[model samples]
Target: MTWVFLIGAILSETGGTLSLRMASKGGGRAWLLAVAAGFVAAFAFLTLALDGGMPLGVAYGIWAAAGVALTAITSRLLFHEPLTKVMALGIGLIIVGVLFIELGAAH
Candidate 1:
């Protein structure tokens, strides 16, 4: 389903972003390859989601917001990065905004 593809896109994008962080920290060729693959898979999955009837605005909004939030949380866990309360509040706002977008689209 579209939702399945959208979830796939979100996860893949998050993976790509995390891989980028790892590569930046001298993870080298393997991590770079992972980054490329993750991003490629992400776009492919996103295309599938759109093809499967998800609206462009809604799909992209969810994908971008979820990817950002997931990447930030995962980075905090894996790399001991700072995720301050203010950043958390911003992520929450992004989710809330996406919800509003989706709700508005239904009308």
Candidate 2:
């Protein structure tokens, strides 16, 4: 289903972003490859979701918003990165925006 593909895309994108950070911090060549694979799969899955009748605006907004929020959270959890209150607020706003997008599509 479209939702499945969208979820895959979000996870893959999050993984890819984290791996990129790891690679930059001297993780290993494997980390770099994981980044590449993750991003590629993310795009492929995104394409499938679009093909499955997910609106471009809605699907992409959800994908980007989820990816940003998730990546920030994961960074804080996995890398001890600083997640300031402002950042959390921004993430909340993104979630709200996505909700509006979804709700608007219902009409």
Top-lDDT structure, candidate number: 2
Total clashing pairs for each candidate = 0, 0
Tens digits of lDDT, candidate 1, 1-69:
999999999999899889999899998999999999999999999999999998899999999998988
Cα lDDT tens digits, model 2, 50-88, are 999999999999999999999999999999999999999
Query: Which parts of model 1 are misplaced by more than 4 Å?
Result: none
**Model 2 stretches with alpha carbons more than 4 Å out:** none
Residue pairs clashing in model 2 are: none
